[model samples]
Target chain A: MRFTIQRDQLMNSVQDVMKAISSRTTIPILTGMKVEATEYGVKLTGSDSDVTIESFIPVEEDGIVLVENIEPGSIVLQAKYFPDIVKKLPQQTVEIEVDDHFNVNIRSGSAEFHLNGQDAEEYPHLPQIQTNQSFEVPIDLLKDLIRQTVFAVSTSETRPILTGVNMKVESDDLYFIATDSHRLASRKIPMGGNVQPLSFENVVIPGKSLTELNKILDDSQETIEISVTENQILFRTKHLYFLSRLLDGNYPETSRLIPDEVKTTVYIDTKELLQSIDRASLLAKENRNSVVKLTTKENNRVEITSNSPEVGNVVEEVTAESLEGEDLKISFSAKYMMDALKVVDCEKVNIQFTGAMRPFLIRPNENDQILQLILPVRTY
Target chain B: MRFTIQRDQLMNSVQDVMKAISSRTTIPILTGMKVEATEYGVKLTGSDSDVTIESFIPVEEDGIVLVENIEPGSIVLQAKYFPDIVKKLPQQTVEIEVDDHFNVNIRSGSAEFHLNGQDAEEYPHLPQIQTNQSFEVPIDLLKDLIRQTVFAVSTSETRPILTGVNMKVESDDLYFIATDSHRLASRKIPMGGNVQPLSFENVVIPGKSLTELNKILDDSQETIEISVTENQILFRTKHLYFLSRLLDGNYPETSRLIPDEVKTTVYIDTKELLQSIDRASLLAKENRNSVVKLTTKENNRVEITSNSPEVGNVVEEVTAESLEGEDLKISFSAKYMMDALKVVDCEKVNIQFTGAMRPFLIRPNENDQILQLILPVRTY
Candidate 1:
């Protein structure tokens, strides 16, 4: 492979692809990034077993020419050093040439680095799926959905399916749900779409892969096309392609875990409630699992308290904007609540609970589409 | 202590004293901050066995009145949580009242925190030294001297005294020297002293303690007093007193370590040299010691090269502004060169050496008083 490309453009594409490369991959070739020069542009691919990220540098962008070459070929270079050298190159354009034995020469200005590149043939082939099941959604909305639910996925390997985010689409609405058996988060968006009316279920993409893809996607209003096949799913944008393998098993039906009826509800200003929980967690954090107790009084005031035998206790009263139903008390992990509240960017939030011991739900005071459920602690 | 102090003032002093406290101290009490209220003001102290820092919140400063109290007492509180709580408190002036049993009530605005405090008497007292030998130096100069020499101090515990900065005061000059056996840095200041002045020999102070003190001291033109006793050294500013126990044992003779001979000499821009070394280190960092080679060609150019047998090699040339003496080649740790260059705040630096194998010296082209020495590696 031989080509000279703009330093900045190459660096940007390299970094995007690097997000999918894992240093701990057992297959050494998977740790390297594959670079291919085409007639149209230069493409860089970085992949582990679960996710693959491919970024393209167009032949010319705005007036800056990215690549100029007569030969088209491919080679794999170490992702760790490739990005660093490209970033630190002393010139506007970088020249890359690979010899017969895969010895790659990268030259810019007075600096030249020769990195031993691996044979592109040694790289495992990315799965090419032909089953045509595809849909489109706004990149910002996709990122928001991933951020709202991905953290709730279980990281444990015992039940591997729980480590992925479940996506369900029915006619005009798409739902994203993730649960770790301790907490559950679900978000639904009314994105009207149809190539053919689809009701696809049991689609689980690894939470870790989605997070990396989310970071690579620009939060613009640009649309992202997502295609799902029998084994692999692809999320493609204008200049990037992200592919993630599907989880083999069905995701647990989490609708039953969220309470259908509420015995008590309280509306609180999110920032004030977040601060109070933070302070209460200070003392509660002394324990292994930081848990804080919340009690709603008859006068719409909620008292937050946490205690540690060595560090004493902290109590704070935050007056809720509104409260109804039977006055109730509940205890839960402060970290889970804080994480849930942080993702829901709203002025006020309402928390609904069936009882002190059951899984309670927190959502925007006025919007009910985004739901977060947390199991209460048996702190009697 | 029963008093109300401004939140900002208390937070600043707490942060300053906390610098001296370490969470891993074997003596648990050293992790606590001692707070004492006197008729004049409140004093906060934190100490490890090696260094102690006491900050005084005066009764009044300029337009800000900090303390209001008639009763006097003292107590010790855990350094970890107190700073966080004080920073997060909701009011301008915080009221702190200590009960007979040392339970403390800290109230600010509508927020109240009750912390279990330890008896101040149990906290170790600051060292009392009859420091008749005292001199004053500018705070900016002291901070400058500390920064220039501290980075070269030995971190290994094999030779305890090499971990300290050696200070020697002659009739008109004060010198600071530090070395880790591989590299040495020395800085000198010409501060005129008394005619019947006390000639002081080399006294070593732990580099770690000086680093903490340097972080706390502001680079103002204010004069700070330095008083050295047999086993302790005190740096007293207007509202702060820094006490550090002298490292026991005789500091090695570092004067002989600095070579006066000359051979190959080169002048280079300090910033350019630093950036080049940073880039060179990236290639060498895969090796155990990260050694980079430098060779001055007869054609007035410097060649920088580093190679790993398995990872290939890199060679780059930089044109020297000026070069003299026999054409030379040397290899040294990139980290040592980077450290030495960081302390030399000059536009251009002149490097002098006896031969390729001997210890080389680097000094500012504008000022030769401050010198840095780096030991070369034997590259096979």
Candidate 2:
């Protein structure tokens, strides 16, 4: 392969593909990135068994020539140092050439690098997801959906299916749900005539895959097409392609985990409650899980307290906007509460409690699109 | 002890003293910070046996009341959570009260923290360090001197004394030198009229202590007094006091390591040389020390190259402004060269080489206050 491309454009594409490459891959060839140059443009592919990423740099963009002097060929170069070499190249334009024996030569200005390249034929082919079960969504909205529910997934491998986020579509509504047996987070949005009526019961995606995809995606209003098949899913944009494997088992039913009857409800400023819990958890961190207790008081006030036998205790009083129903007391992990509060970008939030041991519900006072639930700890 | 202090003022003083407290200290009391409230101000002290730092917040500064309602007493609180607590206090002013039994209550706004405090008498006493040999130097200049030479200190414990920087004072000049048997860095400055004509030859300060001290001192024009004794050294500012123990042993003779004879000299832009070597070392990093080779060519050009048998090689040619005397080729650690180049903040640098096997010298073309020496490696 022989081609010359702009340094900045090549750097960006290399970085995007590198997100899918893992250094711990057992297969030697999978540790390298495949580069192909054709009449259309240059494409780079990286995969780590579970996820594959491909990025393309066109020959010309917006009437500006980005690549020139192309010779159609393919080669795989070690992904370890390829990105660093491309980023630190000493010129505005870089020329890459591969000989028949797969010896890659990269030249820019007064610097030249010769890297050993592996045979591109040894690379495993990316699974093709050829299905009409696809939908279009704005990139920004997709990123938001991933952030709102992915963190609630189980990090342990005890239940492998619980490590992924479950996506369910019915009629014109789409929902994403994730639960780790202790807490659950669910978000729903309307399809708005863009997608046909479709239903998928068990479409579980690994939480790690979504986290990496979210990081690679830019916050733009541009739309991306997501296509789903039996065992794989593909997210395709203008010049990028992301493919991830689906979990093998069905996700657990999480609807029953959220409590229905609310014995007490309290409305408070989100920022004030977050700060109070943060301070109360300082002494609690001496223990393993860092748990804090919340008790409703008279005159629309709540007390947050945490105690450790070795290191004393802390108490914080936060004034609530309003309170109704029966007074309640609950104790839960401070980390879980803080994680739920961080995603609720609203001035006020309402928390409803059913009992001391049941999972409580927390949602924005003004919106019902997102709901977060946390199971309380038994301190008595 | 009882007092109310400005939150911002207390936070700054706590952070400064916490730098001297180490979490892994063997002594139990050393894990706590000693806080004393006097008629004049409030003082915070933290020590880890090797080094001690104290910060004082005066009752008033520049017409602003930093502290008030002070009842004279002292107590020691666990240093692990003190800084975080002070930073996250919920009010403009914080009140701290310690009962006679050493139970501390810290209140701010609607939040209160009750911490288990130890008696101040149990804390170790800081060394007095009474000596007539004292000198004053500008804080900015002292910080600069530490930065230029500290990185060259030997990290291995084979020669315990080599882990420290040797400081020697003679007549009106002070010199600092450090080496790890391979590379050496030295910086010198003239003591102004504020210091008497006193000389100390055995004052060796640990490199780690100097690094921490440099980070705590701000870049200001005000001078700080440094006093030296048989076993300890004290650095006293207007509102802070830092004490560190001196390393005991004779320092190696480093003057002879820098060769006086020069067979070849080259002048080049510091930035260009640094970037070229950085790129050349990418492949060399596979090995431990990351060594790169430099060879002088015709037409005032230098070639930087590194080769690995498994992974190919890289070569970069940098043009020098002037090359004189004999031609030369030398190999050295890229990290050592980069460390020296980073500290020499000059447009141009001059490198003098005696031979391929002997040591070489590098210094800024504009001044001679700092000098760096590196020993070349044998390629054959």
Candidate 3:
């Protein structure tokens, strides 16, 4: 493989592909990144079993040449130092050549590096998802969907199925939900498309995969085509391809976890409540779960407090916009509450509580598309 | 104890004192910070046996009331959560009150915290340094002096003395030197005024202590008074007192390690040389010390090359301002060379090499105050 490429373009592609590369892969060849030079452009691929990322640089685009002098071939170079070497090369352009013996030579300015590369044939191939079940979503909306629900996924290994976000589509509506038994996050978006009778469910994506994919994606107006099969899903953009394996199990039904009746409802400024709980959690962090209590007070006021036997106790009074129904007191993980509040991104939030023990729901006062539910801790 | 202090001022003092507080201290009281409110101001102190840092906030400094309502008393609170609480307080002013039973109440805005406190009488007292050997040095200059030589201190605990920097003053010259048996960095500054007949050669300060002190000292033109005694050295600023125990044992003689005779001389841009070696060391980092070989090429060019059997080889040619004497080849740790180059804040640096196996010296072309010496590694 012989190709001369612009250093900045190559660096960007390398970084994008590197998001899927992990050093702990059991397959030795998977530790390397496969580089192929074709008549069209240069393609770089990095994978670690669960997720595979491929980035392509076009030979010429929009009156600019990103890659040139292509002699079609392929070689796999160790991903360990390849990215750093390409980033630190002291020239605007870099030339990479691989001989028949897989000896890779990279030259830029007055620096030349000769690395031992393995034949690209040894690298595992990414499974092809040839299903016609595909849909398009705006990149920014997709990122927001991932961010809103992914954090609620279970991090514990006891329940492997809860470690992924369940994505479901029904006709013209898309829904995403993640719950770790104690807390749940759900989001739904209307997909106005030509579909009249199309529905697919049970597509669970690993939270880690979504996190990495979210980081690799730029906030743009471009639409990403998502194709899903029984065991795999592919996210395809203009010059990038991201593939992640689907979890092989049924996702639990979480709709029943969110309480229906609102025995008590409170409206408060999001920032004020967030800051009050944040201060109360400072002492609460002395405990394991960082538990903090919220109690309704007189005159449309709420008290957020936390106590630790060895540390101390903190109480913060935050004035609420309005409080209705019977007065309520509840205790929950401060971390969970903070995480839920961060994604609301609104001036005011409405919190509904069925009782102190039942799970409560919080949503942006302006929109009901995003909802967060947290199960209160019993602190009698 | 009772006092209301400005949050920003209290936060700054808490951070300064936190530098000396370590959770691993054997003494239980050392894990707490002692706060004493006097008629004048509030003083905060934290210690971990080896080092103690104290910061004072005057009741009224320059007509600005930093602290008010100060009732003379003292108490020790756990340092683990105190700093975080102070930083996240929900008001500009904070009120701290300690009851008769040693329960501390910290109130700000509508938030209140009740913490368990220990009697201040149990806190370790900072030793008094009543020596007449005291001198003043500009804070910026002192920070610079510490940074120029501290990185060369030996991290290995086998030679405890090498883990500290040797500080010597003679007549009107002050010198600082540190070495780890392989590389050495030395800096000297001429002291003007009242130092015509004073000398102290046995003072050694631990590198770790200097690093912490350097972090706490702001880059200002104000002078700091440093006093030395038999066992401890005290650094006193207008509002802070930092005391560190001196490292015992005689420091190794490192003056002879730097070669006086120069058989080869090369002058090059510091940045160019640093970037070239940084690129060459990409593959070299896979090895132990990230060793890179530098050889003088024809036409005043220096070739930096590093090789790893599994990773490959990199060679970079950097043009030098001038190369004199016979052509030479030397191998040294790229890390050591980078550390030395980072401290030389000059465009041009002169490197002096005596032989392939002898130690070499590097210095800025314009100044002789700071010098770095590195020993060559035998590759054969």
Candidate 4:
């Protein structure tokens, strides 16, 4: 492969693909990034058998020449050093060429690097999904959807299926749901009339894949096309393609886990409650579960408190905008509540409590599309 | 003890003293910060036996009231949680009161914290250095002196004496020197004639202590008083007192390590040489010492190169402003060269090389206050 390309553009593409490459991969060739130069542009691919990322740079874009002197060829270079080398190249323009002996030469300004490259033929072929059905979602909205539900996924591998986020399309609304048996987060959005009326169930993408995808996808109004096959899913933009293998198994039904009856309801400023919980967690963190208690008081006031026997205790009172039904006191993981509150993205939040020992719900006061449920700890 | 203090000011004091407190200390009382409130001000002290730092917040300073409603008493609070608690307090003003049962109560706005406190009488008394002889140096200059030499100290405790920076006064000039036996760094500054003429020969301060002090001391033109006793050195400012114990051993003489004769001389842009060495080290880092070779070529051009047999090789040519004497090729640790070059504080640096095997000198092209020496590694 021989090509002269813009250094910044190449660096960005290398970084994007690097997210998919893991040094711990059992397959040796999968640890390397495949670089290909063709008449159209240069493409870089990285994969660890679980997720594969490919980024392409065109020779010319918007009447500006981004690449020149392209020769059609392919080689795989060590993913360990290629990204750092490209990032620290001296000049704005970089030239990369491969010799017959599989020696890769990278030159920029007065600096030159010669790296041992492996034949690209050794790289495993990327899974190609031959599917006609695809859905489009705006990049920013997709990122938001991932952020809102991904954190609630089970980090423990005891239940492997729970480690992925379940994506389902029912009626005209698409739902993303994640639960770790302790907390549940779900977000829903209309698929819009432009998208084809398609339905998919049991399509679970690993939470880690969505997290990495969220990091690489820039927030833009442009729509990205997503296609799903039996075992793999692909997210594609104009010059980028991200593929992640679907987890094999059935995701548990989480709809029943969310409580329907509310014995107490409270409306409070989201920021105020978040800060209070954070302060309480400072002491609570010394304990195993980092549990903090919130008790509704008279005159629309709520008190948050946590105590660590060996360290100390803290209590903070926050005034609620309004309160109804039976007064309640409940204890739950402060981290879970903080995580749920941070993604609310609104000033006021409505919290519904079934009882002191049951799961509760927190959601935006005005929006019903996003719902967060946390199982309360039995402190009594 | 009871006092209402400004949260920001109190937080800063807590953070400064916390650096001296460590949980690994054998003395349990040392893990807590001693808080003493006198009629004049509130003082916070933390110590790890080797080093002690005390920060005072006066009731009034510069016509501003920093503390009010003070009652004379003292208590020791856990350093681990006190700092974080004060940092996240709800209000700008925090009121702290200690009861007879040694329970500490902290209140701010609607937040209240009850912490377990110990009697301050158990805290060790700070060393009383009764020395009449004291010297003063501008805080910024002291910080610079520490930065230039401390990095060269030996991190391995095999030779405990080499882990400290040696401070000496000779011929009306004060010098700071440190070396790990492979490389040496020395910085000198003149003691103004207005100050008393005094000298100390073996005052070696621990590198860790100096690093912590440097972080606590802000850059300012104001001079800070320094007093050295038989085993302790005290650095005092208007509201801060930093005390560090001297290392208990004879520091080996390092003057002979720097070559006095120069067989080759090269002057190069400091930034350019630093960057070239950094890039070459990328591949060299795979090896143990991260060694890179520098070879002088014709026309005042120098080549920096490194090769990892299994990975790759990189070569960068840097243009030097001038070259004189014999042509030379020398191999040295890129990390040491980078560390030495970063502190030069000059646009161009003059390097003096005796030969391929001997040590070399790097210093500012025109100034003489600072000098750095690095021993070359044998590659061939």
Candidate 5:
């Protein structure tokens, strides 16, 4: 492969692909990043069995040349060193050439690097999702969907299926839901009439893949196409492609986990409640779950408290905008609550409690699309 | 103890003293920070036995009131939680009160924290360095001296004395030197007859102490007083006191390690040489010591190269301003060279080599106050 590319454009593509490359891959060749120069542009690919990322730079875009002197060929360079070398190259543009023996030469300014590269033919091929069913979602909204639900996925391997986010399309609405048994997060976005007539159920994408994809996707209004097959899902943008393997087995039905009845409901400023819980958590950190208790009082007043016998106790009172139903005291993981509150993206939140021992729900007061449920700890 | 102090001022003092407190200290009380309130201000102290730092906040500085409602008393609070509490408090000012039993209450805005506190009497007293001789140095210059020499200190404890920077005052010049056997760095400052007539020949301050002290001291032209005794050294500024137990041993003589005669010399741009070495080190990282070879060529050209048989090789050519004497090739640790060059605050640097086997010297081309020496590795 022979090509001269802009340093920054290549660096960005390398970083995006690097997110999918793992040094612990059992397949040694998979640890390398494949670089291909075509007549149109340069393409970089990285994979580690579970996830694969590909980024392409065009020869010219908007009349500005990003890559030049392209020769159609391919080589796989060690991902371990290629990224750093490209990042620290001495000029705005770098020239890369590969020999018949797969020897890679990278030159920029007066610095030149000769690296032993693996034959691109030895690398595994990317899975081709040959399906006509695909949907489109704006990049920013897609990133938000991932962020809102991915953190709730199970980090433990006891239940491997719970490690993925359940993505479903029904009734012209797309829903992303994730639950670790202890807490759950769900976000729904109206598909409107823009999405094609396609529906998928029980499509559980590994949460790690969604997290990495969220990091690589810029917050732009540009829409990205999503395609799914029997075992893989692909998120494709104009110059980038992210593919992740779906977890095996069925995802558990989580709709029943969210509480239906509310014995107490309080509307409070999101920032105020988040801050109060954070302070209470400071003293509660000694506990395994970092549990903190919230109690509703008279006159729309609520008190958050946490006690650690070895440390001390903290109490903070926050006034709610309104309160209804019975007064309640409940304890739950402070971290879960903080994470949910952070992604609420609204000024006020409504929290509903069924009882002290059951799961409760927190939702943005202005909308019904985002909901967070947390299983209360039996601290009494 | 009772006081209401400006949150920012109190936070800075807490952070400063926190540097000396370690959670793994053998003495349980040493993990707590001592807080003393007097009519003047509040004093915070933390110690890990070997090093102690005390920071004070006065009732008023300049025309602003920093502390108010002060009652004279003292208590010790867990360093683990106190700093974080002060950081996230909900108001501009924080009210702290301690009961006779050492129960502490902190209140800010509507947030209240009750923390268990230890009796201040159990905390060890600050060491008394009673000395009639003391000298003064500018805070910024002192910080620079520590930065320039501390990185060369031996991280290995095999030679305990080499883990400390050797400090000496002679002939109206203060010098700081450190070495890890393989490399040595020395910096000198002319006292200009303004310092007191006190000289110390064998004072060695622990490298860790200087590093922490450097972090705490702001870059300012204000002078700080330094006092040394048989076992301890004290650095006292207007509101901060840093006391460190001196390392107990004789520092190895390092003056002879620097070559007195030069076989070859090269003058190069400091930044250019540093960047070139950094690039070469990228490929050399697989080697234990990250060795890179440099060879001088005709027309003031120098080549840097590194190779890892299992990986690949890199070659970079950098042009020197001038070269003289014999043609030479030497290999040395790229990390050590980079560290030394970073401290040379000049555009051009003069490097002198004494044959291929002897230690070479690097100094700013314009000054003789700072010098760096590195022992080359034997590579045929």
Candidate 6:
């Protein structure tokens, strides 16, 4: 392949695909990125066994000359060293040429590098998914859903299916739920589109892949189209495509896990509660094995306290806007409570509970669609 | 004991002394900080047996009201938890009170903490150094000297003396040197006296203590006094007093290791050479062991190359400003060279050598007192 392209354009394409390049050297060729030139533009691909990313850069955009080529071919170059070199090149335009034997040469300014390239024929191919089973969602909403629920997924190896986020789609709404058996988080958003009549439920997507996809996705409001097959799932944008394998096991039914009614409801400013939890955590560290206690009396004031025999005790009286129902006292992991509160981007939050041992839900007062749940620790 | 202090002032003092606090719980009391309320002010002390730091906060500074007291006494509290609590307190001033049984109560707004405090009498006392053998030095100059020579100290415990920086003083000059078996660094500066005459020959200060001392010293031109004793050395400023034990052994004579004659010399831009060294290291990384080769010709161009059977080879030409004496080629650790160059605050440096097998020196053109020596690796 012989081509000349803008240095920044090539760097951006390399950065996107480089995330999939394997650092393990068992298969040396997998550490390389494949570059192919056709009549339309240049395409780059990188993959490990579990995930693959492919990005395409067109020859021209508006009046800007992005890529100029005289021949069309393909070659594989080391991804680890290629990006650093391209970023530090002295010239604005970079020239890449490959010989028939796949030896690649890159030149910019007075500096040149000769890298031993592998044959592109040895590269793995990407899986194809049927477009009929695909659905579209706004990128902002998708990233928000992932950030809210992915952290609650089980990281331990007890139950393999629990390590993934349950993604369910029905008619016009998408619901995401993740739980580690100890605590859970759930979020739902309404996205109207052409409905696929088949109901899809309990589809497990690994939390690892969802987190990585969230990081690489930019803050653009453009829609991302996703297609799912029996074994693989694909995310497609205008210029990029990402694919990952689906989990093999069945996800647990969490529909009955959420409590039906709340015994006590309290409305507190999110910032005030978060700060108090952080302070209460100082004493709670000694009890990394225990939970922080929260007490609400007949009035609107709530007291947060943590006690450890060796470190003494801390108490903070935080005034809430209002408190109702029978007076209640409960204890829960300070870390879990902090995690649930941070995802709530609102001024006020409503915390609802059924009992000391039952799961409690926290929701943004303004946006009630998103909910966070925590299992309270039973202490005598 | 009872006192009220500004949160920020208490936090700063706690953080500074915490550097000397022991993280290892061998002796439980060593992990805590002692706070004493005196007629003049309040003092905080933290010690780990190797080093001790005592910081004093007067009754009033610039009308900051750092401390106000109703009674005088002392107590020791766990250093790890006190700082975190004070930093998160909601009020501007924190009120602290000690009961008859030694239990302490800290209060700010609606937040209160009851800590288990240890008796102050159980804490180790700070050492007192006589001022008969003391001298004054600028804070910036002392920190610079430590940065220049400390990295070359031997990390192995086999040679305990070599793990410290050797300080020697004459009638009008001060010298500092450090060496591992493989490399050495030396710096010298002329001294003037508004002080007493000092003719100390050899005092070795532990490299680990110097590292911590340098971190706490600000880049100010104010003078601080350093006093030495048979087993300890003390650095005292207006508000802080630091004491460290001297390494127990005689330092090796390092003057014989420096070469007296120059065979070949070359001048290279500091930043230009550093970047090239970083690039050449990429190919070197793939070898059985990464090693880079350098060759200097009479034509003022230096060549850098590295090769691995599995990764191929890379070579680049870097143009030097000038060359003198015999043509030369030498190879050393890229890491050592990078470390040496990073501390040099000069634009152009002159690299001098006696022979290919002997240790070579890197020194700036304008100032020739400080020199960095690196031993060439025998790559058979």
Model 3, position A84: C-alpha lDDT score: 96
Stretches of model 1 off by over 4 angstroms after superposition: A194-196, B194-196
Write down the C-alpha DockQ for each prediction: 0.60, 0.88, 0.88, 0.84, 0.93, 0.49
Give all candidates' CA lDDT scores. 0.85, 0.90, 0.92, 0.92, 0.93, 0.83
Query: How many Å off is the CA of A199 in candidate 4?
Result: 4.5
lDDT of 4 by residue, B1-380 (tens): 79999999999999999999999999999999999999999999999999999999999988999999999999999988888889888889999999998899999999999999999989998887788768899999999999999999999999999999999877678889999999999999999762354445558999999999999999999999998877889999999999999998788877868778999999999999998898888875566579999999999999999999888899999999999999998999999999999999999999999999999999998789999999999987
Candidate 2 vs 4: which has more DockQ: 2
Model 6 agreement with the true structure over B166-233: per-residue lDDT tens digits: 98875566888899868888887787663335435679999988888888788899988888888888
For every model in order, what is the number of clashing pairs? 0, 0, 0, 0, 0, 0
Q: Sort the candidates on lDDT, descending order.
A: 5, 4, 3, 2, 1, 6
TM-score evaluated only on chain B, model 1? 0.96
Candidate 4 Cα errors over 4 Å, as ranges: A194-196, B194-196
- lDDT: worst 10-residue window of model 3 chain B: B193-202
Write candidate 3's Cα lDDT for A1-380 as tens digits. Answer: 89999999999999999998889999999889999999999999999999999999999989999998889999999999999999999999999999999999999999999999999999987887786778888999999999999999999989999999999876567888899999999988888883333345659999999999999999998999988888888999999999999887899888878777899999999999998888888876646579999999999999999988888899899999999999898999999999999999899999999999999999999998899999999997
**Model 4: lDDT to the true structure:** 0.92
What TM-score would chain A of each candidate receive against the reference chain A?
0.96, 0.97, 0.98, 0.98, 0.98, 0.94
Residues B1-380, candidate 2: write the lDDT tens digits: 99999999999889889989998999999999999999999999999999999999999999999999999999999998878888898999999999998999999999999999999999998877778788888899999899999999999999989899999865656888999989999998887654554546657899999999999999999999999888888999999999999999899888889898999998999999999888988886677678899899999999999887788899999999999989899999999999999988798999999989999998999899889999888888
lDDT of 2 at B291: 85
lDDT, candidate 4, A1-380, per-residue tens: 79999999999999999999999999999999999999999999999899999999999989989999988899999998888899888899999999988999999999999999999999998878788668899999999999999999999999999999999876677899999999999999987664455445558999999999999999999999998888899999999999999999998888888887989999999999999898888875556569999999999999999988888899999999998989898999999999999999999999999999999999998899999999999876
- Docking model 3 quality class: high
The 10-residue segment with the lowest total lDDT in model 2 chain B? B193-202
lDDT of 1 at B72: 89
Q: Give model 5's DockQ, 2 decimals.
A: 0.93
Q: Kindly give the stretch of ten consecutive residues in candidate 2 chain A with the minimal lDDT sum.
A: A193-202
Encode model 1's per-residue lDDT on A107-213: one tens digit a residue.
Answer: 87766788889999999998875656788888999999999999999989999999999998756668899999999999988866553544355599999989998
Q: Global CA lDDT of candidate 1, please? A: 0.85
